[model samples]
Target: MSGLAAGWASGAQGRTARSPGIAVTIDDFDLTDTPLMSGEERDAAIRAALARHRVKAAGFVAGKYVGDSLDPAVLARWSDGGHILGNHSFSHRYFGGEDPAGFMADVLKCEPLLSGYAGFRRLFRFPYLAEGKIAAGRDTMRALLKRHGYRNAPVTIDTSDWYVDNRLKARLLADPRQSMEPYRRFYLGHVWERATFYDGLAQSLFGHSIDHTILLHHRLTTGLFLDDMLAMFEERGWRLVDADKALASPLLAREPEGLPAGQSLVWALAKADGRYEGRLRYPGEDGAYEAPRMDALGL
Candidate 1:
């Protein structure tokens, strides 16, 4: 059986009338400045929403921004509230674009900072999902991570908030009259595309559930829609696995699958029928969201 299939077999053996099939993960919890609140206040606002939903999810935080003490304090709260901390890399730079050694250093710096309070963080989501071209792709990243005992996250769905706010920003610049509605609407529109991308990814990759990880951003724009985000997870009947428990999967023991896939089916399905406004028409659309990628996103 494939490594993916082994997961199905284990789930089948443990199945009961009440067993569930999948789960979702959310991260990229970064915030700098905002119009409505200070950075700390915004963090509190987002945390308030998570607490209110009684939702437990993961936050792939920037180690330097939160600082060691702040990183652990916030992570512990999220973990206690039911969220896990994944690696966003200490710098949150585009890891795939950097020199092999330089990239590994920045990435590894995050863990020791977190380990100062939390111990080693085993799960890694490449900054920006930027796993470049194939042979060169998996060769450097997978090997470097293996050297440090980190697992590459298999992202089945991406909320793509990274593009949303950037697009929102340009809109405000080009057409200053455009109101906050655009940002609000894009934020609200993510849940549908999120599920579609996630489901499509499952069918393509594992042919079944297999603990899929869904990427989310803690960017303030994403915060606008977070209450709904958490509700989607709860309503879907999934629980956030503790990052520690999540890391223990054998999938992490080595490269879970081969390197840089040129196209994940989720992207194709998303292209044809994705309804999430954020992914549907990004930075080009009217919103504070910046950043646009025609090639990488295949839009």
Candidate 2:
């Protein structure tokens, strides 16, 4: 195991050890009605699912989505349900191509909207998971976050759940009575596959399983099947932990030396190490990668 990996596992023996654990971290709370449900209805369903599983998720909210058109109470629901709210920037700008001052200003702009929530935390997730394309840019942002007492929220198991949701919505719009079984199966299978792949990579790189945070979004797909997803993890011998607890893992705090700095944290670390080239992919997970597989299934 590498020194970085060793550091991640240093205090493991003292904790209540179990199988690899994961926490739910949702991003882009884009509140809009879809073919399947109204925005409010979707929010209720997602909250109910989380309540059913007793999971406290971290919701990363982008400020632009929280407008006068939508009720602010929709966001209060997350806080009421005991989930933490984090900043995902105001404009949801891609930081890799953004001017540093503008990006920093956008992040600061989103902070006020979240401050009122009892569950608010000074955790910031980069929109599109793009930190920056250069070392100086990445470090400048990092320094700003540090000075503001914000921790960069990193994703470990990144999935294309948004893509699956898009297809499912389109199918529903075409035929509301279409059997959802196929969509359910595909979503579950895709998530599990990515989970195992990342878990294996983490074990190989860290020589131990680090607590993971799976990147999901607030969408119809998550609202409908989050309960099933949580059950799947539990049945597979993985512990479902609180988002804050999972995020506290020391490994998440380590910044990789790679120039174009963000992806799944494990992927970025491996890229920095330069030994896992064959097993990694650039832009770790995206809709494009899943398009062909879904097309083959006619989904």
* Predicted structure 2, TM vs. truth: 0.92
TM-score of 1: 0.65
**Cα lDDT of model 1 by residue, 153-207, tens digit:** 6554555566675666555557767666646654545544454444433544434
Runs of candidate 2 with Cα error greater than 4 angstroms are 1-17
Q: Candidate 1: misplaced stretches above 4 Å?
A: 1-28, 67-76, 79-82, 134-137, 168-182, 233-299
Least accurate 10 contiguous residues by lDDT in model 2? 7-16
On residues 1-299, what C-alpha lDDT tens digit does candidate 2 reach at each position?
22432333322332225467989999989878887788888888888888888889999999999886457898798898889999999999888844787788899999999999999999999998899998888988998899889999999999899999999999898899988889999998888778877776787788767789999998988888888999888777788899999988888999997978899998888888889887787778888988998899999
Candidate 2 local lDDT, residue 263: 90
lDDT value for model 1: 0.53
Per-candidate count of clashing residue pairs (backbone under 3 Å): 17, 0
CA lDDT of every candidate: 0.53, 0.85
Q: Locate the minimum summed-lDDT window of 10 residues in model 1.
A: 281-290
